[model samples]
Target: MNYKRLLLCLLTGYTFAASPASAFQALQPLHEYDKVSKELVETLEGIHYNRPNIDDAISSKAFDYYIDALDPSKSFFLQSDIDSLTQYQNSFDDALRNGDVQVAYTIYNVYLERLEKRLLDLQEHLPEMVKGFDYTLDETLNTDPDKQTWATTDAELDDYWRKRLKNRALTLKINGESEEKILTMLERRYKNQLRQVDQTNATDVYQTFANAITSALDPHTSYFAPRASETFNINMSLSLEGIGAVLQMDDDYTKVVRLIPGGPAATQSDLSPNDRIIAVGQEGAPMVDVVGMRLDDVVDMIRGESDTTVVLEITSSKGDTQTSKRISIVRKKVKLEDQSAKKEVVDIERDGKTYKVGVITLPTFYSDFAAIQAGDKDYKSSTRDTKTLIDELRKENITALILDLRNNGGGSLQEANALTGLFIPAGPTVQIRDQSGRVTPLGDTDATITYSGPMAVLINRMSASASEIVAGAMQDYGRALILGDQSFGKGTVQVLQDLDKGQLKITQAKFYRVSGESTQHKGVMPDIAFPSLIDKETIGESALDNPLIWDKIHETRYPVYWNIPAYLPVLEPRHAARMAKDPNFVAINAQISDFKQQVETYKTVSLNEKTRIEQQETNKANELLRENTRRKALGLDTLTSVDDIEPIDEDTFAKEASEILLDFIATNQLAQQQAEKKTAQN
Candidate 1:
């Protein structure tokens, strides 16, 4: 079955249940919301993969999630406010069962009140605060909410706000904004926050509260309001005319899920996954602070006409430290051709022999279902495109192949199964476990093995969903050596279901490898590991809230073509020695190590101007040193500063993998020759 088509159909049409509850004055749930809430709870309890018992335990957890969703940084509501609502901690399940969402509305109203009052206070006092700012004082601001405590009193919150506002102004000043401009921006930002708070309706509150409860079940499960469902459909259809990125609300920040391959952010900018979008600015406008902005509004601010420039201030966090960078990108459509699989031949010269290794870089597992439905003979698909590339590589007399699946955030499920068929003759690729505890094996029935020669499948932390399936299958059958970092542990499948109000994207199934291992929390490990730049603490499925745990079922019966593990002892040491000496490899590892050290050291940022400037300069110098070190090793011209460096596609990973493949070939050939000699001697 074509899952994409099914999902698109499911998401396209959604009906509104009732008018949302009014906000600002006295927030209360609409009378019709009771029935809508009842339907949502029933759907989730009946069809969700976990089928979790939404008891007091779940209700309590949901209450915490709801609180986090509203005031993630513990900035808005005070301890007294939470204390007053503590009675509802385990009462949410009962509220849902009775189709009464008064508690949800009440909590939201309380949050709205705190938010509006805070924004109003900021607006009134921002100018004076900026005027009285003293940057010379040595102080630090702990931005990590996890380390922060809830404000016990209103005065404590007031003090926190003072530092926060001071830090904001200081950051703007460092960015070369004039004092006047900083004041103006902060005033406008607070005004906007107040306006947004006033505009929040009952539907918005319901959606957030419902999502809080659903997220307690799993991260993938979510409720989309009517308008949000429409937005989601547009995104899935890939018709949005702007920077191609999947963004979701993470606390108060808009976080990047993944960048669409070939889009401006993916190709022209350095917008990595898990980076938080702090602010957005268009062509010549002043940057708009979007810290507490709604997800849809943030998306609207970033999106615009093709060729227009959108500037994004991105903050990437590791541990408790974050590095912020502003990137300007020219918006454009993410075309299918750009995301299509492409092949290259990497010629590795070793022992006077030039071994040509074919490398197929698959950005995503995509398919043009529309074209296929229209009876078009040639349709775009990962397997079809890859098979064509393999034939071309064969014509070039390539000795081996590498399926580069790095940062491929997965697309079509059928494509993954079909792509796996190109390697093995015929076998199950992955297993699906549904809510009813039924385990079904899905595989390629095709008997033809397209490229059975020595191969390696490259994966990384961003290689998720369908990517994991292909990599896991390759590892299971011993058909290809899996390389690079562990695959992203997102094995669950979600389907959009229409609700009485909005839509519910619920987790319906979980994916298991051919070897019966569930690729849920613990992703597929590479046969040979490489130093990864992607941070696992923030970017993988395991990093998400309440992710499904990894488990095992009965392993599928499949023939192992080769014993790749048996050759690992010899291969690993040789690979490691090369990586340690290789210039590019050394640079990559050094950069990763340097980042880890920075994360450890910069748990809190200095608010003092002189200290902060010194820190920035020190960081720049260290980065420049590392760049020069790699350049000098490669016999290239050394850059004077990190800013002077141009983007270079120095794929040391693939080059090293080619060397490993050559070793495997040589070792296997030697083993076969020795076996023949031993047979003759006997």
Candidate 2:
């Protein structure tokens, strides 16, 4: 089956009655193999949307996913290897159902052979390949080979590797590192790659195949190997007792992908993304090289009891050389205090009058289920903490409010209900549609209004799921205005089920707002949006290949608070006029445009020095232009170069948002007063 036919069938519905919810490799144990596959099929077929059947179409999808997993860059597994696997594309469903992934395992073995050949080729050629930098030498590498055809011949594959290594060296060289140093680093990187490739276990291959199958069902649906399952649990419970940063395998190196806000790494501002972990050590012990080590193994090395310090040897992606440095951080549990909602008051002055805007930033819609189960009343949760914060802010006599739900990727649905309750007084917050075509409304039974005042919910592209529920609720009820970029647009909910001693996270339901809008692919649109740098088309749920489409259902009945929506028409022009002349907003807009253009340009890069130099110069100039423009607007000195602009601490995004709230308060109150006067006279 070709790709087009497979996708056609994926979208076509095929129902099965039983709802229930596989391993091919050494990274996962084939625990209760019979039960896991059976359960997965039942759960997906019975509970999931569209009830996609595991026929030739799904099997073909699994084939594509598994192949993509092994060779994401399309660098390995030549056309011949892909052609050979064509026969097995229609058999994955049958093979996985019977607890036999031997065919998948055999294919993985073929990939292993290919990897060995590539490594040998690298070892043989790299020494002679790193001779000189030729500005005139012409070559082009398709970095994103996902859409590119696979190499039909061995020679084509060889050229791919050759250019790949050349590009690596060329980038380092262009960044101003010495030739000797660049070669040395490349050698080490290759050797580490070889070592890590050797360490790839059968369980890992099984995970790849299993996930391929589940992901074909839905984007959020996934299969986790046992160790990966443990990691998932640690992440789900925000009591991050390990290193504050989430670690992922970037080639052979354990790369710092993101900093958990308020965690040790984020709190200190000592680490940045792309900082590769090379080695780890305790206060008294010798450092252990973690390069080429398994991600879980490296994480284990870094984790320790609270108050214990761990030293990390990092290779910074910034600067000329691959700058290696040691940084130490004391291990501590990522406290609920960190993710907890906090209150602040930003006093904005307009026309000699001040408006105190109460701000409550919710990190995530969290609930301590364990603590609640244990009967602890003092348990920390997003909604409870927010309620307490709102009460405190109310006592402070704030005039307006901003619920900053930026980067809140969501948590407990129960917490979402409660948080939405804080803003909305009555009726259902959102609706959930299960696989059986049954629509259930999740209402906030608690009719307590936390604060009945001028309100705005501040969000960005990172805000999602539970966060969207609260924002959508307030918007639907006309209680508050939504600000910032469109949200992450994740409407589906998942349930984790134990399978083969591992776990399967499957999407069972989707979320719809009270206003009948599904917050699936099309997230909540802001009433007054700010200039955002995020490329929404490429970054959010809309960007995913097989995302659930945006749609509307029957609107649920909900009580309006203060008719904020009616006032938006009068306020939006004021907001837009302010944004038009504002330097920060202008800078952000320019940056957004520049980023998109760069992405477009990055795709067609030439392997020549002049092109590279010119590209680098253009990027630098554009960044500095924005920096200088914003600085000049702020009456600060303009930066001379890119390096000078790096440490400039000026993110006035939220400050500007607060200003917008102040404007809303001033305008809305005046309107309210005018209405009262007219009513009294009448």
Candidate 3:
């Protein structure tokens, strides 16, 4: 079937049910098995993939999911496609049951050929195909204004990408360098740097193809070939045996964005964000040129058994270049507890009175899915962990609590609901409506309330999904004050549907707060808004290309809790007055303005001279340090050098939020006391 025709049928024939309650009943486990069997056969036979054993295993799993999703009972798949796809089921089963690698490989090759042809056809019609498309690729490459070039046409984009790919390939092949010579050079270069160099051409091609496919899908989803997959799993499990740093390909150079605390890099205290990696080596070995290499391949070279030594040649964000300096440390698991929420008591002394505030920083709403599925009694969920922390804070006489949800992408819906229950009384937390107009009311069954004091939620553009839910619910109920920049604005709910044996996460429904407002395109707006340093114009769902439109649904029933007046007559003026006098706020605003100017003037530097580039980088770093020192002198925390500000801790910002909440609470209490006095006098 043609792609367009199949999509049309699926869209028209499938109905989005009202709620999971009614729709879930129709889904049967047996139907899932049947669908799985069929998809597995078709995928194997049609694709003609090589490596039958791996193909069958993957396809079988993909089919199970595909069937479950298409099963009208469980999902909204079109019946016609389901019926047509089923015809190949037996063939897939036969291939899998027989372990036919050749057949699988053949199927895969055929599919790949078709895909290539389609892509080429699209390229031929590029100009017409992308007519009126408004999206622009993020200009992350240009750091200097004069060297920047923008492409607005599809043809231009296609040509640009093609050239980029070709250039990368040339770098890998060393430009007409003989295979034997190339291998020799690579081995000598990385002899001391890497454990081994897997210089196979096949490995390079596979990685390139995988990267291309993943880029086409989205920025997040990626295909990690066997060895790469093992590395990824290790990282996810927080059990890396090397320096704790996440690396990614950003143009020609591999950039470091995160440094896991307590890791070798973090302990060394030399490596910083945006630092370019130039060469790598181990003890008594020559440095290898890692520039222009695939990120995964470079990563493989970096990882090793614990307590082993590796040398890294790094170019600091500033103009200074440095060698490894022989920093060594024992590699240990990045304990999940390291990523867990941490509580701190921030005492704010204002007008001769000390106000004790509790600040809780939640990095991510992570849960042990494996343990949960296994029905482990002690499965760790965010809600349970947060509840324990809240109890501890309450005992310490915390008058207000600041729930810092910055950079928290989100996790399970069950935990979102449970966390919401902690703030508000037992009630409907959110409404989930599928395509069929069925609405499922997910509520909090727990009767206990954790913190009932003044509360404020700190979020930025990165906070999304379950984080949005909790923020939206708290705002709707007037139970907490929402502060910080606009949220990530992801209100859609994705359900992972198993395709034959593979997995497909589809946007099955839209989420609405108890008050019936969808947090889709319009994220939860803060009651008291603050300017953020990050660029919101380039972030969030609204900034995405071809994103789903924002809309609303019928309201759900929930009791109105707090009735805080919108017009905080004295509150706004008081905040304005305070901000005017606050040097920290003034400095923050200035820094934000400077960053905006810098971003606007961004261009690519073309200097081939190392000395010139080094000087420029040094100057820029010095300027940044000077600006940071100035801000610090103005009552903000001071950093002596740029290295002091390695990984940004949004906790300081969260503390600022807690102070704002305290101001609001104090003003409200004062007003209430005045009203009571007036009544008594009358």
Candidate 4:
């Protein structure tokens, strides 16, 4: 199968007889589970790219993953509980090979017990605790689990819970929540968590264990149970009736992973990647705290009939104080047309001259496969749409072009190849190395150049997969200048294989640039870097667990269009000079620096209400000052509060890129004239 299918589509036809057990059974393995486990092991060992040996090393890592997945915050399980399970640390390999997973069920059973006990205790005293919290107490709650150790005794664990609950209460109180409201919300949250623990089943434990095993192989590899497979399929369809954002469980919080192009969250809401979703609410209903809730249940609550509204309370990753705000979105199906490539022309004034620059914004490298298979000559694809937009922009006499691929999570592989060909003459664009060490070079065969002009490609941390292929190709060819932050660094291809019970997504191949550099981990580096609002520590491929290493293969022979380094010396200094005085750039750079300072300075949340309120007020004041600074620089009326700041232009990066392109054009003309003069003198 082509790489375009990548992880999203499934290969069906394989089937196995399953036991007639209820969908939700007691926390135990089914009669047919042993056979399925054996199949899973065999498939992973035989077909996976790594062909990993299921030995003590893998078993040890898998065990750690299993325990961490259940208790990521290390709240319930104690050191004693871990000591008891230590014997099974190296036994997972043997159990999986021999078609047994009793150890997995055993560990899950212990986790359930711990969870139930903790939730019950919270339920019993949370109301009283909420009302009795001494807001002036000098204490702190270490939110970073890695910085704290597990409690050794029941009293220690109780103290930990007390601090956690107090921190929660103080945060709410500082946010203007009444004690009665905090009591009601917290009581319901703990009760719901307790019920979820009681409803744990065999399938739940099995899915977690299987995924732990697969994820240990690579971050992209995963196992999906039947119900999870259905949810995955709905996500792939791009028509799920929801806010259209991918949510993943991060510790006890639901975090937004990525926003789907053309989706409601991407188009309408202020939702952003790495933002933690604290709560969800329906129209006219009270906000439901989703902390510690099962991800499936939260998804169910957020998704509803089309044309309805869903409200989310989110804390942005960029925030210093971790304060939350609510945003409402109207649920709707993500339409393909909304994601299509579009273009506009901007006149950039440089050296007292207005240069018409064309900007083509491609949200994704999408292709209508159905239309192509139906032999429709007028099929829509990124390459075709981009070519059309370029023709239209050429009519406007645009001097240069900018392809804005910011936040463009890629789609079709073929589209990336063809789109690269539009700027350069046909050549190898990407190399695919399969599991068997077979390297296949794929590129555009038709020797046709659609847009041969000065160009720059803009990318950010969210531009990934096919986007990397195109960006890397452009950089390698020296046909276009790459600008913005480093890309999302996802260069491997994965395919979903149907198993007897659940599906296994296995990484089957690796992507390499034509220059022989693997984009698996390092992604494409920009010619000129820009300050990114996205936190690199929380996002990108390098932040993931068990990410594949970056390596290289033999470089393919291709003609370089221009020597990009020669132009960078002239362009970089001018660009830097302009950005130094630009208010937006100054503000963004300050925010990034302040974020780094805060990360180094504090790792805990204060439980004292006074400390928290003071921190919150200081953060709000600083935010307002930054906004007013930008407003004053732009000659606009200064905002009294940060809330008065209107949404800024999304094309700010593209506009700056156009100015850089003007510099490049000027430098190129001067170089050509000097070369001609030298030749004439000789």
Candidate 5:
């Protein structure tokens, strides 16, 4: 049969014998044969992915499956690959069953060679296929093979097989060796790994293949497995079980990306972003070594029921090992309100006068799609919530407003439009273009302007998507003075298209500001940029392994422009004067510098002597925190203790943002007074 036809046949009518009774069901005879046939068919046909037939499809599939087999806990492989590879599953069983090591080695070598070649092809083709490709995988393959090093050549493969047999023999030495004894040991290890496969979850496999296809087409397009979908829902809703931290596997370690406020990890007073999880242990179970494991498998191990304890043995970037005390936290459903825009009033004393500036902390631009689709009465959304907050701030008669969007990873397009509309009069907010060259305008639906007085927006590398939209609109219209580091350049818009049984989050369009500048790879640059504490050595779209390049479209017509020549010239000098004396800013820059150095050094740490390396990391973190506290005190925002540095309302970036806005407003007011005096004199 032709490859395409074979794939269609396999997909259309494939079914397992039945769901296993428990997580520990043994592999049935002939089941292996059935799986191998399906895999071989899929491999030849190339129909496993949503947008298949790409050159990388076969290689991507091989890499994915091989990774899955090695680290079953966090592997991202399709159910099809598992089912197809089943025929070869009994290769180990048959060899050990009949005391045939040579046969087993030969079978493993064939699969291993195919996988290695495929990975090499994937690495070679990636740069040409994708723009701004970082070549991370290629670098990884060249630098380290870890356990996979044993399967490189025929001799190495034979040696690995021999070692496995020798290990089994050594274990049975005390008990005296029998064919059954060696076979049982091999079977137990194989079954233990297989049980972690989660065969029933087809969504897991489908999403991996789908994401690879979408990623190949463009970075914006993605596929979310059922678990990922659930996680997305939790993120959108602003809550999740287990540790309240975002994680990604970097090399062999699962590193902390971001920590959610009020979440167990954030509240624990010990867990930190950039910490590497080396091991994971459930209550009453031996800790499992998670080093060099796949991200998905690690995630599976970390997720559990509410109030259940999972110990995370972590190592810091500086190589300090710290065993986190078993923290007991009841996983509670976090509402959108909890993670939405939180407003506060900051009183700053400048030149013997008190200035009340309104600070609005926007954690994320979240929208409840389920409630909105159902037309519910109380659907919490970013635009709606912020509008209400703006009205309340206006009621308080605040002098100015600072919109804090630092670390916000973007959300709904509607919210971005509405939020921008609050500052600018009714007009086109942004323009979007599709793959087929179709242009669509997304405009402001509201007429009422909110907080038109002095405004400033805060952004950083993590501030992306909807955050970029709002910042871009505000800058384009001269509505708000942009502050902080460059924003995360993620302007692409994705639509979750529901298939018959699954869904595809395809990159349907690319968003551009009213001025026609695309926030693709080059994010929004701030008007008054502040040094960021977070290291950007490996952050944002530009820093990703493979990212799309920045592009622009025709400018959308919008009737808005702020003549800030007089204001900007004077604002720069005044802000420069304050920055010189700002101890907090000085300290923050130093910390940022230190962090960059640490990141550069961290890449070279050896896996051997992990315990000693981890200790150094802990010491570095504690010392940094202490220095930051001292700096904070010097600036009148001193944190008394490290514990006092609560994740709650305590954002140094946001705090500095209020001062930045105050400075901007002060400069503008001074310029306005001078202009009026000149008019009077004339």
Candidate 6:
């Protein structure tokens, strides 16, 4: 069988057959789970990458992951509890295989007890701390506790929790909420959190343990519970019925992060970033206050069958206060039109001539699978839409093209292959290596070149998966000059497997560039790396725990643009010169410096109101100075304060990439002229 089809069978065929007695009879002391545990443990040992020996060392790691999944930041479980639980570290694998999960349940039960006690402590102690604490004092609390030690004493934990509560209060007070409202918010939040924790079921424990086991293999490998699996599929197919806005927990409030490109929320335009969803309800149902609800719970309430309406009570901050708005949105299928390839032309003056540089911003590498399956002749996809945009841009007499993949997280592996086919005279685009070390060259064997003009690709740290594939292929073939920051390094391939109880997303393959270079930890480097807001140390595959290490294999033979090395010499220096003088880049450098300082010098902020306000005003002043620097460079009106500067509607990076495209044309044009001159002289 061919590689892809082989993977399809092997990956999706993973299922656990159960006996009549396989069901759990009790909450703890798992003697009854012998059959289920044996099956799961055996499946993982045999099928997972490396066929990991689940001995004491790996068992210890699994235990660590399981415990950490429940409590990262060392927020719960005191040192004594941790010391008591350390005995089970080397016993999990044996227990998992032998069907003795009493230890797992014991740990979980203890955690639950700790959680209950903590909540009760908070309920009693929060108001006392908020009322008694001297807010005018110069005290500080370290917010991030990634490497913090576990609380040695209950009194020590109480001190930590007191600061946490005080910080929460201070944040709201600064946001113009009265002490009464803040107290109410905190009470509701603590109560809801307690309620949610108390409601954890057996299914939740199993799923949590399953994920701990799987994620120990790799960060991407995960076990999705039935409801979660359904959600994942719905998202992947992009056929879910909901008012499509991505939401996140901002303190106690469910905040609208962003509307999906062509969803009902985006079309409505009433919802926005930083807007808090205070309440939600269905048509004819009483409005439920969702102010302190869990993000997932809020999402479950928001998503419904098609044509159904969800009313959201939103509040956006105005200066130091909040203003409310009621927005009703009808759920519908997400429209892919907005995410499709969009074309723009930028004119840049260089060397006494203006070059019309074409820009195509690809939001995602998507394919309308449903339409394709239904045998529609004109199914929507990245390659198809890109081809159309290129044709249109050619009609505009563009000199070069910039494929903007700045925020493209990538989708559809086939689309990446097809999109690369549009630029090159067809060769291997990517190499896939399966579990058996079998190498498969997934390429565009067809010899079709859609666009042969000078080209550049714009990518950032967010450009990942299929985006990396396309960019890697182009870079390998010398088809395009890759610009911007290094792309996200996610080269491992995974397939979703259906289990009896849940779904297991397991890494099955690794993707290699046509040049035999792997993009696992080391992503595709740019011809000209741009200053980025995303830090390499914080993001990318390398940052993830247990990521696949990069390695090279024998590269597939292919022709490439050999003149790229010679062409780059002139362009690099010219671009660097421009950037040194460019206002936008100067502003970016300053911001990057400020961001670096914030990350490095993370000293605790003073609780004193005057110092806090003064610091905030200073931050605003710096922000305004940076904005005005860019405005002065662009010859726009210089704003006096941060409030005067309007929201940036333009893609500043894309515009700069377009300018770089002009440089590409200029450099190539000069090279061609010199070639002709040398030939003429001969």
Candidate 2 error regions (>4 Å): 1-35, 132-136, 145-147, 175-180, 227-243, 247-258, 264-294, 297-333, 368-377, 562-565, 610-614, 644-651, 666-682
**lDDT of candidate 6 over 221-312, digit per residue (tens):** 77666654432221322236988776655445676544565678866545654467877879987556675566677788888999989888
Better of 1 and 3 by TM-score: 1
How much lDDT does each candidate structure score? Answer: 0.83, 0.72, 0.55, 0.82, 0.57, 0.73
Question: What's model 6's TM-score?
Answer: 0.85
Clashing pairs in 1: none
Q: Flag regions of model 4 displaced more than 4 Å.
A: 1-26, 228-239
Taking all chains together, each candidate's TM-score versus the true structure is: 0.94, 0.83, 0.61, 0.94, 0.67, 0.85
With candidate 5 superimposed using the best TM-score fit, by how many Å does residue 266's alpha carbon deviate from the native?
4.4
Q: For residues 1-682, what per-residue lDDT tens digits would candidate 5 score against the true structure? A: 1323422432211111122233322222222233332332333233222333434343344334434433333222233434554554334323222323233233233433343333333233222222221212111111112323323333333223333233323323322435544444444433333433434233343344334334445555554543555422212221466666778656446777666644666555466556777667787875565654556667777777767777776755322222222233444444555677788888778899887788888877778899989989788888788888989998988888989888788767787888888887789888887665677888987777876787888888788888898998888888788888888788776666544334555565677888899888888998877776555645677866446668878888876566544466766676667666665566555555666665554443222223323545554566557566645656546454443443323455565667767766767677779999999999
Q: Which of candidates 1 and 2 reaches a greater lDDT? A: 1
Weakest 10 consecutive residues of candidate 2 by summed lDDT: 13-22
Global fold similarity of model 5 (TM-score): 0.67
Per-residue accuracy of model 4 over 1-682 as CA lDDT, tens digit each = 2212321221111111122322232377765778778888898888887788878999999999999989988889989999999999998888888888888988887887677656765676566556656777677778765687877975556667777777766667776889998888788778777666656667777878887788789988888877655422223332489888887888888888899888999888778888888789999999898998877788888899999999998877766635677889999988778889999988887678789999999999999889999999999999999999999999999999999999998999989999998988778999999888889999988788878999999999999999999999999999899999999899999998988887888898999999999999889999999888788877999999999889999999998988998899899999999889988888787777877766654478777677877887887788788878888998988877766665557777888899899889889999999999999999
TM-score of 1: 0.94
Evaluate model 4: give its lDDT: 0.82
For model 2, residues 2-41, the per-residue Cα lDDT tens digits are 3234223432111111211101123333544546666667
Alpha-carbon lDDT of model 2: 0.72
Tell me the alpha-carbon RMSD of every candidate. 9.1, 9.0, 15.2, 9.3, 13.5, 11.0
